[model samples]
Target: MLAFRIVILAAFAVAAIAFPRAAIAAEESCPGLVARRGLPIVPASLAADAVQLTYIGHSTFLFETPSGVRIATDYNDFVRPRTTPDVVTMNRAHSTHYSDNPEPGIKRILRGWDPAGGPARHDVQFGDVRIRNVVTNIRQWGGETTLRDGNSIFVFEAADLCIAHLGHLHHTLTPEHLKQLGRIDVLLVPVDGSYTLDLDGMMEVIASINPRIAIPMHFFGLSTLDRFLARAEGQGFTVERRPTPTLTLSRTSLPPTPRVLALPGR
Candidate 1:
């Protein structure tokens, strides 16, 4: 009888060893536990409240963080901004959006797609800024082939603001994509009707994102830009064309209603 009891006890110990109760509890209640300990929930905002965004033409925009961190999107040699960037992001759809020979001085270079035809993963923090990405599929060979996880939506978080740049997006976002994006305060979107998603599909994306401000990019001519502006205006978005290509933004400075701002660019 004592041997039988010892065998049952040994079985129970093995089960407990395989599935740790403490680990399960931690996994289920980590957030609550941190809150109870008074730990910081999110990263603190930068000392300076405003972040500057500069249009560098054709899907390339330079983001200047308050702490002097500069990030350029779609960084290729042809349309790259004059000043060197601290960090640069690229997409793989075309050579126009990426460069094989990036300047050696750049601190970080992030690519949206893996050269091996896999998904690219990036989550980096530098100074006052944090950058992350969400993967999406793209069309290749003139829509003859669909490459899985071929593009990325880069998100920059700084000064308590979330800025997202849709890089060579070829389709409407899925619910999983929205969950990954969270809340975007500023959105940089492509306005080219045929190359990226159609005008109607792009409008649907804007509505789903619901950013406080939307900036147009990737439009080759005024006609494409005008069509996007008109559609946004029809949806009750305030369309404003800025004389300059740069804008400084902060949480407090956001418009009461969502606005589409057009910056002059090549």
Candidate 2:
């Protein structure tokens, strides 16, 4: 516990010094902007240059692009949307995060781990939206053995927006991972506290990503979600509790200061 606390403290100090200025400067339209709480989020109509993200539940999200392509993240049987999506991405960390039997009519099923015994690699283009992935490691059930290249962090590029869905992430990203990530506008992150990275390490991951907007998911209850929200607030990020489950953001709608947008869902 002491060592964990020390890591948190060190991370806090580093984040306090590094993230704010960098996140602000990340967007040209956001420089010299002041951070504020309760930033207004306009319900996105998904304009010509925008994309939409609707939280289904858990780590699953339905991403709709302007060109009419749909992508589902963490395509599990437990929390799939009613309508089949054009493409689906899944992680193998848990049974609830992926499905053994996906719908045959579904166009593409991008699993994080390859069934043939290797890391999954994907770079598929769907209309104006392009989907790709960066492989990451995961801890097996009960935190026993660490599996190398067992999971994926999928990035969606649409309407000039870069959104990343970190599926069942168990560890902080390496420098190489960040290099592949580049700049991210929105992030879908897990905040289960125990199942994925604890609040401390998760915050560390957010600092490393420095996304303009972050929406928390993969939590079992409200309290677990609140802890992650509080951690982001402590790191000087503005927290916005959206009344709706869907969040729409384009380059023009991106927040100047980094923000944690809490959409209502699982």
Candidate 3:
């Protein structure tokens, strides 16, 4: 198993929480590769200035850069891409959000939490992609415990675009976090209202990041996704539910106004 937070929980009472999942059981360790339940994964051949993305399900997304470097976010046991990626990012909120055993072909495995008792720090330049992270706090043991450096918001820079995945984020970004993130072209966010931050706080986070495009993820089902779409529409942001979960975009293809694109996936 990859390193997990097993230290004693903090005695301090948390005022709020981060992420909580319904199911908990012994994890089934497997190669984080192979087709997900036999779903066909179309091979990507991106242009020199474009990026291809597939919403694998939940918080997991497979991103192919212009240079053919592949990256997977929130790689876990339940969801993943068919082809092995060069890099994989995992969040430790629960088993559904991370994998106990990642496949061997993956060159870089970035964990949101550090087992050495501090925030995770990463800034890697691989192939044609530059990936980094900003540490955040999380609530553990069902909101009663606090882990100061529990979560991470990973930012990937490639093809002259900045992409971010908000992994089980608990709170809004502070000035420092925003500064570290710089400018994001596309953002992958969580919209499961109760588990992560509430809808309103998530909206606030979106505003703070102010990405050109925002895509909702970790929404367990359609009702949850619909709720987020309605919330986004009410906030004056444009909302569009795409016909497919697969996409390819570039810096020049961004919408005139910030828009929320709901890609169908688990």
Instruction: Please report the candidate that would top TM-score against the real structure.
Output: 2
lDDT of 3 by residue, 1-266 (tens): 11111111123232222222112121121112121223332444566667788888899998887667789999998898888999999999888778889999999999999989899999877766778898998889476687899999998877667888999998877777776776777899999988888999998888877776899998877999999999888777768777677777777777655778898774
The Cα error of candidate 2 at residue 62, in Å, is 0.2
**Candidate no. 1 TM-score:** 0.82
In candidate 3, how many Å is residue 20 off? Answer: 30
lDDT of each: 0.77, 0.76, 0.77
Q: Which pairs clash in the backbone of model 3? A: none
Clash totals in order: 0, 0, 0
Q: Ten consecutive residues with minimal summed lDDT in candidate 3? A: 1-10
Per-residue lDDT tens digits of candidate 1, residues 7-39?
A: 001011111111111212122221111111222
Compute the lDDT of residue 141 as modeled in candidate 3: 47
How high a TM-score does candidate 2 get?
Answer: 0.83
In angstroms, give how far residue 208 of model 1 lies from its true place.
0.5
Alpha-carbon TM-score of each model against the true structure: 0.82, 0.83, 0.82
